[model samples]
Target chain A: MPDTVATGPGPAPSGTALRELTFGEAIREALAEEMRRDPRVVLLGEDVAEAGTPFKVVKGLVEEFGKDRVVDTPISEAGFTGLAVGAAMTGLRPIVDIMFGDFLALIMDQVVNQAAKIHYMSGGKWKVPMVIRATMGATRRSAAQHSQSLHAWPSHVPGLKVAIPSTPYDAKGLLKAAIRDDNPIVFFEDKISYAKVKGPVPDEDYVIPLGVADIKREGRDITLVATSSMVQVALGAAAMLEEIGINAEVVDPRTTWPLDEKTLIESVRKTSRCIVVDEGYYRYGITGEIASVIAEGAFYDLDGPVRRIGARHVPVPFSPPLEDATVPTERDLFTMARQMCNK
Target chain B: MATAPNPATTGVEAGTPLRMYRQMIAIRLFEERVNDLYTRALMPGLAHLYIGEEAVAVGICEALRADDYITSTHRGHGHCLAKGAAPHLMFAELLGKEAGYCKGKGGSMHIADPATGNLGANAIVGGGAALATGAAYASKVLGQGRVAVCFFGEGALGQGVLYESMNLAQLWKLPVIYACENNLYNEYTHYSETTAGDPVARPAAFGLPAETVDGQDVRAVHAAASRMVERARRGDGPGFLLLNTYRFRGHHVGDIAREYYRPKHEEQHWMAERDPVALHAAWLVSEGLADQAMLDRIEKEVAAEMDAAVEFAQNAPYPDPQRVDEDVYA
Candidate 1:
């Protein structure tokens, strides 16, 4: 049976907790806790050493765990990612950072073809227990080459567990859970949330199990489902809806692949309306997948057509104004939620 | 690094054994039948036959135990048979039958049976090297005195993933044996045209102990693989053995005749002069282990097995469409 507390919880107590930690700090804590608990656990990526991670999430990890466990590889995502897969197959649980989510393109063969299908192709004779961390979202105008919310790509590939954490609490718990998972997990951390989002995280090592949704705010008018940076925007929109007596429920599906659709359906059933917010481009995106599942599984329960708010179908721009326009915003979520509620 | 020794001198026992000859014959007959089946349109997907390169698989696999794992390339029927996959299942898999390993989901290029530790063949070039490294690492961790053998062609040496895997295997002293089957061609392109320099130097530059061996001699391959497997099992780190061999067929079944790619005489030279299985069989018979009658019997039995496999595959049912979503997780 599944752990009851994972679905019905105030907060897990036995796991390591970080109080008021930035998104980066929470990730660091998760890696530290997993490494400390399992001797087979290791960390590897370019600039993941004394220089810290490209986003500073691996700060002080090398100093604490020594250079052997905190490996800093050459600038080759395909090569190092394959090496991490090798390490994982050999009995080492590796947490690999790709530095930028956009760079995942360089190692698609390793991530999609090899790591994702190894266990099943091998008839369950082997399990690749590895965590791949990549920073997503267009922050600081990194533009097309550096900043991309590429979680949708990994989510499409079978045999991979995709996690996109939106807050310090989710970041820490999800990272810990991914490290301990028997499958290969791709954990995307939104660059915009690196230092901005903070929340209460317990000091003990605990796991926020995958495939479970967290209801950020419970209400009856509509359910706003979001991921990563969009979660915050949805919450902001929900707050705005309350004053207008809409009372939207916000759902954050911390992990995207083994999705907690049951929770999502239940919330949507009560509210009779749903708005999916995503940072990726709208056409054939993760939002489309979520909406399709809901339409297929709970179409009769819905009182209003499900609306999706995502980035416009355009390459992420460089200029601040254009970039801001490309990504979905609180205004977009608010307008969609209001439309759904009024309908 | 130690000086490179002659592979024949380095790893052979006093005399070639009858069992070794049987394995070589089995691989050759099985591959030839698979090629015939592919040509007859009985097998599904593409097939990369290992007709001319039988020595490398038979030699190396003979050095491994049934429990020791092997990761193969697309041209994997030889490796699968030599590693002890039942001939019937391998043929059935090529025919896309449920009786085959992977239940027909993995046809020609993706057959695997972990029961005998044959950890599937990958269609992507150079993809299985890192996986084999991981399997070896797992063996070490689980306290199993097992070694992992990864087989790829000369072309894979250029992939950065192989270099990365090689570095990790050496650095961590993982129990992996990298068998580079240098067949002198990647599809229609010759090695000289694609590779910048010698392939052996690449691994040597990465600090891995490497050697170039004559891939046509089964005795030589067995001896070298035995030493490398022993070194890895004892925790001495990874070894790279570059087997100098040739692939008689084009890259895959249904390939156009490549006389334009190479001189016709060179093709004849390799096909007639360097047939690994025939040479190994001759050695076994000359040394008084077996005769022509025994070789003929083995060939007949292997053919019978393949025929039965084809029958089973033709009659087997396809997987239900609903089960497509199954096995994606866990």
Candidate 2:
């Protein structure tokens, strides 16, 4: 297991007092600290300055950094995102808040074509050290337009780095590292987990390097490789598995691209059985990519086929029951793990 | 909209007009060399020549400072040269040599040099508008006091992002100039068929100070661009300059047959009467600025320079095959 704090409703590590912070608060703290540290870092999005976004994550950043750095833009996703790419190219390290992951469709040209390829296209003469922070996950009752886990889109591109944070600690540290990184990165926050999830966060500045996986709870029976919002589901399933004597190891890749393939392969090697979980589509999604990696790396070590669990291949519905059914739940994982292990 | 048909006789330094004349010739000779390379199948890809619209690029870019930023379109050789890029480097880039700008990654459509403040030529129509606007936004936020000029064909009027960028630039009073070169055609179709309503009204609706000038007259373009550049530099918002010109050649080098969209007489009419180079040279000789011998000597010098640049690019080495994976990330 990686040398890190124990997560998932666990007790604090010995001799270290960790402060409890909500996921939103952790994200806000990261932005605040980075902006204070680097004057070039600026935040721009709709209602980001005063309204602090609908989630109230950045409620008081404008009061501290003032309006120049914490700018509020019109509802022009392509325009501002394109501008942010250019701004990042020239001087400023812009953090473009894209509101929702579904809105990524609108700014695909800027993100995929412009921001991601600027460095390579210019023969590495230009650097787009920018972060596009957008929300993902489903079951929000906001319908398909507002909810999506589209981190796979940027991850598919070559130059972009994709970060998917699972908890408050990972959210703060990974976001800080995303801002400081030289390449353009897409940071996908679980909208559902912003207010619902809480975890221990250190008071001082820290950077959880991208591509490092955190094993939330270690076990030998099986490996539950998860990302973003699914990390919580995997942990919950791990708890349920413990009640039966099936010990499931929960591993959060944290970042989809620049993926911690070593940790994932090593976990699969130890467990011999694996299940990949993600919030993106089940068909041709992150689950398939990770499942293939496990199969390729630990082909001989595996006892059976590596299974994949993800959101159903459909638009997330508006109704509560239907929306709930669209996404993979902890119970679904627990049932799948039991069947796969023949428990 | 105002039009000055003739080159101005006053209010310009003696050497300024001569330099402008030389720059326009340089662009013309460069395009000639490009067309030659394309015809011989020596250049890998075709290029959109900046032949007839040299006056607009020369005039506007002459008004910009060395540090000011400019975003160009696919037909951007004139803009790049006017902004001080070396001819040999540009030819090398077009030929995909390792010594080119962008290290041969970006070809003719994307010659970018930070030293010259060229943000890169965009192959996508209207793609560079927001980028230039963003540079202006950065200039405003960082107090750089630099003005950014976005150069696009009139065809970009159809793109919504152009208007979006203009609205933002105006709202923030960002130092940007939207230079629309109305070359009268959007690929094969005439812009009038694709564009509805007046072009200047679009920017004017966004509260931008818009003006239309005679693109054939380099002095008029220079004068108008200078005023707008100064206005933007002094904290005034962006301005839209509509350059009413014509495309002397087809859209790209491969687009030779013009009977489909354009008539023979029309092309002949523009080339014979409204050629910006011929018009400027005639005015220069008539005003006693230079004789036929001096103009011929300028053309000779530019022709020789372009010849040497083309040869340099022809002999330059291609990038190593193993280096294909390089520069993928910073």
| Alpha-carbon TM-score of each model against the true structure | 0.87, 0.95
Residue-level lDDT of model 1, residues A205-251, one tens digit each, is 66889988899888888889999888878878888888898898989
Local distance difference test values of all predictions, in order = 0.80, 0.89
- B65 in model 2: Cα distance from truth in Å? 0.6
lDDT of 2 by residue, A1-343 (tens): 2222234542334566688788888999999999999999999998999999999999999999999999999899999999998888789999999899999999998888788887877777888899999999898799989988888899999999999998899999999999999899999999877888888887777798998988988999999999988887898899899999999999989999899999999999999999999999999899999999999999999989999999899998999999999899889999999998999
Q: Which window of ten consecutive residues has the lowest lDDT sum in model 1 chain B?
A: B1-10
Clashing pairs in 2: none
Q: Give the Å error, residue A112, model 2.
A: 1.4
| Separate clash counts for every candidate | 15, 0
Candidate 1, chain B, TM-score (2 decimals) = 0.92
Candidate 2 residue-wise lDDT, B1-330, digit = tens: 111111222232322777788888989999999999999999988689988899999899888888899999999999999887889999999999999988899999989888888888998899899889989988889999999999999999998889889989998999999999999999999887999999999998999998899998999999999999999999998999999999899999999898899898998998999998999999999999889988888788778888988999999999998998898878
**lDDT per residue (tens digit) for residues B1-330 in model 1:** 111111222222322455566666667777777778778877768888898888898888878877888889899988887787777777767776656677666777887876677777988999988778777766776678788999999888778788878887787788888899989888888888989977888888877788788999988998998889889889899999999999888889787678878777897899899988788778878987668877777666656666666666677776666766655556
